[model samples]
Target: MVLTGWASMLAVFAVEFLSLLYLGTLQDEAVMGAVGFGSMTQFTITSVCIGVTVGGAALVSRALGAGNLLRARTLAGASLVLMAGAALGAAAVFLAAIAPFTAAIGLEPDVRAHLLSYVLITTPFAVVMGIGMMLSNLLRASGRGRQSMWVLLAGTATVAVLDPIVIFVLDAGMQGIAWAGGVGRLATVALGGWLVFGKHRLVDWPGRRALLADLAAIGKIALPAALTALATPAAVIFTVSTYATFGPSVMAGATVVDRVLQLAYSLYFVLPGAIGPILGQNLGAGQWDRVKQTVRLTSRWALLYGLGVATLLAVFAPRVADLFQVAGPGRDLIIFFCRYGSFAWALNSLFFVAIAVFNNLGYAAYSTMIGWLRATLGTLPFVWLGAHYGGAVGVLLGQTLGFALFSVIAIAVCSRVLRSPPTTDATARVA
Candidate 1:
């Protein structure tokens, strides 16, 4: 499971890093920033799908643990139905509102046009991602993590190969980048569908009543989880807006820093994902001690791994900065942010682990609160202060400090919650 989780994250890091690497080689920092905005536009919707992914995994794990395979299959089918419906709706809204949305965020005209093109090219197929999310989560929960990993890797590999051809050779520019990703996602949906529905036949269309019941079950868990997931993008929207105030170079630098962080902290982030099924099944089986042990051991591993990542980022800051071909203030800001924010990787790891535990244990609302705190209380004020006083560097400092503060608070809250008595089966059902 850990290997699969690691592979899944690695695929994303590879794709994004390659994209940024290619973009950087152009020596056009503004285009790089535009690319960043393109990514941010994509996240505006996919983050909402996190609820579906997390919910599907949690429910499926619990059902399987209780030997309710049939129920699990029904839930899987229902999730597909839900994802399709939601994806179509989201796509329509994004297509219609892209212009206004861009304006509301105060994007520069050139960047806004670039972002619009990217969103328009990719938004309609947003369901591909939601389907991929559902199928991958179901595969992981069913302990077919390796299979799921292969599906995503194949798709990401397709993107990696096509990215250069589409962007450089074909001269498609920013929009080409989105097309590359859409092709990759299309591949993921095809393969994932085969795995979930064709070869495995894991999903069976239950009657409408049964489907709706399962949808309700999924929604019960997914809504809060989705909100929790939504917090990051919402916060990113604010953070990016804050960075925009510093001008395009800073925005591009910050965008580069985000991609770097994703790469550096990929392993640490996977720890929480890898822990999800373990915690879910154990908690379902009433093995509280084992669940607690798993959290402890994996969290310790996350800390150690995070420290290693921090060390590498700090030590290799110059080399990493050079990879982006950024110069002037943009280059300096990227290096400074990487070194300064490296330690926050440890804090982020702790928070990820805690949130995973909370969601799997049916305290998703708690997870939501923690995420909100990290985004709002942890982020906004500090970012405001740092932007006001310290400029671009101060923004990084503020966000890092916010993570540091919330991580401790989240750890304490999760620890206390974990030690509390388990809920009764009836109470669990109501939740």
Candidate 2:
């Protein structure tokens, strides 16, 4: 799971970074703007893709828990349907508005045109990306989390090489990047599907009717989980708008910080994702005691995460900043502060254990609420204040404040719940 998170990010950074360099070479502000703005679209696709995948997880987990292997298999069939639907939607959106989205994000003209071209080219293949997501989740739920990671790695390698080759060397331009992305996605999805559906029959054979039932089941689970997945990206858009108040360097710095945060948060993301199936299996088997132990253990893990990661971020901020090679002293300094802010980044991960526990128990509302707070209330206003008051540094300071606020509130709420007596079916039955 962690590897997928990281590899997914590798594709992002490599592509975005390359786009920025290409923009510099072209000396086009619009091009830079296009890359920066296009990120929102990328994030949007990823969030939706994740939401769709989680729906699959929820379905498989529940059906498996029900001790109905037949239903579980049926749910698997529905997963393919969802994948097809997602692909169709993605392709439609990408085809229709890829260029416009870039323009809307305020990309400069030449860059916007370039980005639009690329997005359009790859839009049809977005379905392939969605398929890969579904396949990966299916594997994970079937107790093959390791297989999912390998498939992701393979895709990442393909994109890692192809992105630069197609865009930079081949001079296929922005469109080339899209083609690369599509190729990698297709290869990954094909390979993963072969293993799970054919080699292992890990889930049910996907039939039309079976898939429909799975969709209905998934909708119930997905709404909450999908909302949770969206929180960060929504916060990002808010952060972007707020950073605009301070100017591009600040916005760029914040974006850089966001990228850095994404890279590191893979560590935090790991336990929550991996532990979900563990919790699912145990919950299904009616091992309430195991669930209790796991939740407590996972929460502690979240608590410990901030201090450890934050320390590392503080220590390595400068070195990390240098890696991106953003131009200009001002840009470099902006990135420098972003790296330094890694301390706050680490501290902010406290909610991980809490979130992990919530997700494992299928407590989507609680998870989604916290996520919404962090992204919406927690991040946006503070970033606005930073830009309005202190500039870039203030932005980081505001982020710290937001994280501290959210974490304190979460821990307090969680503690209150923990202090309350545990509820069990047996207890209810006795009552």
Candidate 3:
């Protein structure tokens, strides 16, 4: 888990450089708002991947925990099939949605055209990322944390190495910028494929009936989770609308802040991800008490980690802001929003760990709701407020408020539900 943090710490170097873009320096708030929408083009894809990947992870983790190693491996084969489907969908979506989707962010004509072109060219990479993410999550749940991190390591390293060459030297412009990301993600896919297909060979030789069961299991859990993940990109759509009302700087700041927030989230990813397999296997083994302990310990760790990062942000808010962008007049507002908004989101460690536990314990419904709250319900109103009065700052407040509410409600729910996880696989199998 700590190594995962170290890996994430290293990731900042890559993320900082790749995130910034000029977009012709905020002519109107609408152009600024376009930053969020345009930026989400990738995330809308990634969020879809997350939603889908969670299904794969949940199924694979359960199989791994159940001591059905062969079954788990077979399910991985099924995942390859699903990822192929995702690739086809991504291509079509990009073709159909690129212009209109980019336009909806409401950027100025020139700015929207620039943004749309970037999205159109880069859309193919969405599926490449989908494959990598699915494999990584499968590995994570099977207790191969380092292996999963390694894939990201390769991708981030590739992106870091390629950014300047692609954008400036090759004169790819936004496409070049997008290419750096796409190429890096392609590297991740390659490495992940090696692990899943070449070395492990889990992604070969599938049984159609069993594969259908695997897909069904994944769909049951992932459907709601996917919807939950959609909330984030959807919220981005809403938040971008608000930032659009302000100016590009606000949207720029939000984009920058999201990078930092993602870096922060990598910490959450490390432990819960590591613990998910442990808890799943334990649940599969019927070791309910140990499953309980894993959740508690991971949550404690998450809290400690969140506090540590919050302290660092508080102490070095200005410097942190600078890493994302220049931090001008709106610097104060953006910094406040990002730093505090992250703090609130950070506290979700308890809930997040709890969600992982629920997934393993066969309460996928419990796990799914939090994603919905954060992405859909919580973020929506904040964007509305940010649009009406607060601007970017209002959205930050909305984000923080959403997490705060989740934290409170989750604690209450976790307290009651943690007492008992479902005892049998048959009972737990909602699918």
Candidate 4:
């Protein structure tokens, strides 16, 4: 499960990083910045849908954990219906808000055009992505993680192959990249749908009332989890907008840094993500000791993993800068960020693992509170201060300080939750 989940997450980072790397190779800073802005903004915009998926995953995991196959199947089907609806709504919102989104982010006209082009092309197909997200989470939660892995591999491979063809061979440029991504996600939706329907089969829709009950169950988890998921990206949008004030160079540079950091963080997320289903199942089964043990052991492993990744980032900072082909102020900022800002990710790993634990245990509201505090109180204030006084380095420092402080808080919260008696309600009826 760990290996498969890790590999899939890596592929996701690769798809984003390599696509941007191709843009960077074009020597068009505006294009790179546009891609970055579009990507980050996409994440922020789809956060609500992400919350729904997470909520569904939690319910599915708990249902599977408690051996309620019928409930699991019903929840999966309804959640898919909800996610598809949300995707269409999100698509419209993304299109309608494009002008305001770009202008608020301080993008230049050329960059804004590229960003608008990318979002306009890809936003509608976000339905495919929403379906894939829900299916992947459900697959993982249901113990068919390898199937989930292959689905991601297929999708990412499609994107990897198509991106260059569309951008370079077809001479489509940014729009081509967007279309390529949409095509890739379509493949994901196909394969993931097959896995869910053909291989596992969502139990069977019991009846309207039962299905609605399952959706209400999912909503309880999804709404808070979605709000929790929003905090980080919302903070990021604010910080990115703040960085944009320094001009496109800084924004572009920060984009490169963010991707690199995400690559590192993906590695960090492997265990936490793997742990989710395990904890969910165990919690559902009322295996409190196993849950507690898993948390402690994973927490230790996470700390070690964080430190190792940070060391590598510090050592390879220059090499990474060259690989990305970044130059001028952008290059310098990437290097500085790699050397200094990367270690904060070590702290971030702990926070993520803690979040996974909280979410899986039906403590999503607590998890949401933690995320909100970290993003708003822990991050924005510090980032605003740094941007005002110090520029890029200061901004990075401020973000790092936020991570450092919140890591402690997150750990404490997880510890408190772990110390409690395990819930006997494996179905998460209360949540």
**Predicted model with the maximum TM-score:** 1
| lDDT values for all models | 0.79, 0.62, 0.65, 0.79
Candidate 4 lands at a TM-score of 0.95
lDDT of 2 by residue, 300-411 (tens): 6655765666667667766655554444532554444545565565555556656655555545567789989988789888987876787667766776678668866765
Per-residue alpha-carbon lDDT of candidate 4 for residues 302-376, written as tens digits (9 for 90 to 100):
678778888988998899988877777778889887788777767877787788787777677887898899998
Candidate 4: which stretches are off by over 4 Å?
Answer: 269-273, 423-431
Residues 95-210 of candidate 3: C-alpha lDDT, one tens digit per residue: 68767655665555655656666666667777887888788777677677778788778888887777667655675545566777788888988998889778866655567888
Pairs that collide, model 3:
29-244, 29-246, 29-247, 32-248, 33-244, 65-281, 231-375
Off by over 4 Å in 2: 1-33, 65-67, 90-115, 205-211, 245-251, 299-306, 328-339, 411-431
TM-score of each: 0.95, 0.82, 0.87, 0.95
lDDT of model 1 at position 87: 67
Model 2, total clashes: 6
lDDT of 3 at 330: 45
Query: Which stretches of model 1 miss by more than 4 angstroms?
Result: 425-431
Residue 67 CA error for candidate 4 (Å)?
Answer: 2.0
